[model samples]
Target: MIQNIVLGQIKRDPRSVAMANAYGTIADGYFAVGYNPAMLAYQQDKPFMLQLFGIDMGIGGNFISLQNLNSLSGDTIYAAGENPKNPHDDSKDRLFRQFDDAGGLAFRQDFHLPMPIINYSSGNMAFTSNLVWMSNLVFPIGILELLFYGNGRRPNMDMTFNVEVFGVNELGFTFAVPYDRFALGATVKYLQGLFYFGVDPDSSRANLVTSDYHLYGSGKYLFRFG
Candidate 1:
């Protein structure tokens, strides 16, 4: 048995992302709600801060990139006919070689939208609200090989994949109390689950086997939603 898990959260501020999350100690105002709320105490001189509108989004993948897309855009990786146009082309082989044996190719995306009129900060207390959405997908290398090279060379293949998506609305109240040498701060958050969808790995199975005289395969996928 083999299992893998990937976990991540989207950065809510561009400055945090640009600084590679090193801005936590210095974060102030409404931005400190998610990082170090204690830092909010240092913003006493700013009077008040209001966030009218803001959006953060990101998308990327291990096996997909601008360079790879440009290189494989017009190339035909596979054809069903007996005589194909590019019979000597190695594009299919090149694509198959990109994956390793350890794990599948993965892609992820996330979006964050701060509520406009509700996000505000004053004195040592602040209130904020946001909507967040996240998605992830994985394609097994075995499935890619089967798609690119067919069953002629590899008689057996595994067709397992993973996918997940979820969304949530968060409302938080933050407060900070400053002392002579330190500060105490905390954030109270209310989370409302908007939706969730994913494949049940424990209940899903798929495989394929081919031979000269016969071909056999089985597939069962269980999806869950909330």
Candidate 2:
């Protein structure tokens, strides 16, 4: 089963979740902080933009299911399908069979913490301070099988697991310059390296104990451009 911790929960912003930040109505106010800073240059003459604490989550995949769990929890579980008996014939069917119905997991999360210390607009000139963060995780079908059903029903061949997880935080200011029917915008940013962890282990015929996670590196810096 998939488990996670959920921060402050509240009514979600319909607009932010309804569509991607790239395409949507400006009337909705403050566009995506990462994409098209220039779009904010055309705000509807609002006095202030307040983007306090908010969280967004996206989960998708087709690996873990009632069938998979049932098989794993049975008194005397057996491989779903009999292992290819005898010398397998070499063909497209033989090679692709490994991933037929293995299973998978994917997820994305956004944690907002009173970002944009300051964000206000008037006329053509727009000024703002923005802070944003995001995290992504995915697990292929082969990895799931080795982790969940490797003991009960051992399969043929070996597999490697290289799962990755990291987060990025950007602190910066955005300004826009308008010209007749056109306008330009730029953002100066200070990037902070929060953390990064990795694990590289060959299943070695479905050994449960893998490898230890090692500390890598983390830092911060400043950069800006259009």
Candidate 3:
């Protein structure tokens, strides 16, 4: 497992997200702060721009969808030694098949709220701030297999899961200097980490093995905070 923190503007602008980041070249005003600060110099006519209130939110996953949720909502998963409500139901098998050999399911959610009265642009300079929150989760295929099918088919199981949640306030000052045929720009950013909570995937490990007579497994989880 690999874990790292990457700091930058990711899907912060609704227009950019809608355009699939194709707005980089024509980005202007407050939107140019991260996409391309040099584009700010092109906003000669728009002397002032202020963003009072705006919000950008996104949620996505590999195995999560409305149809999938509706299909599995009524299905019940029973514990070991417990009688299942529907013994012949294929819901469990269907759910297990959703995961591939690489992994079970991965999910991510992010929210970007531009601080009111702080996002402004004047001429070739801009000051912007945003409150950002993000979270991620992963369910390993081995764990899912063990849960649904037990360790009878696969004697050995690799159980590795990951989770991360963090929030930060990004404050930036962007400026541009235009020349005859070119422009130079820069954005100074101060990332104030509000909080961080995650499981250290590299250090966390878990495994299970089953034999004819006994089953054994061990797990260790390392959590991080800031």
106-211 in candidate 2: lDDT tens per residue? 4544554434335444443334342334444544445555554553443432333234455545455566665788767665666666665544333212223332
Q: Give the winner by lDDT.
A: 3
lDDT of 1 by residue, 39-77 (tens): 778885757989888887778787777798887888656
- Poorest 10 consecutive residues of model 3 by lDDT? 1-10
CA shift of 220, model 1, Å: 2.1
lDDT by residue for model 3 (1-226), tens: 1111432453246677678678768786888876778888888785898989988787888777888788668767544334466556565555666576436689888888999999999999999888988898888777777777777777888777889999989988889999999899888888899999999988998888898999888899999998
The Cα RMSD in angstroms, rounded to one decimal, for candidate 3 relative to the true structure is 7.2
Candidate 3, residue 27: the lDDT equals 83
- Sorted by lDDT (best first), the order is 3, 1, 2
Better of 2 and 3 by lDDT: 3
Which pairs clash (backbone N, Cα, C closer than 3 Å) in model 2? 63-103, 63-104
lDDT of each: 0.75, 0.43, 0.78
Task: Give each model a TM-score.
Answer: 0.70, 0.49, 0.68
- Give me the runs in candidate 1 sitting further than 4 Å from their true place: 1-11, 60-103, 144-153, 210-217
> Candidate 1: lDDT of 28?
66
For residue 69, model 2's alpha carbon misses the true position, in angstroms, by: 18
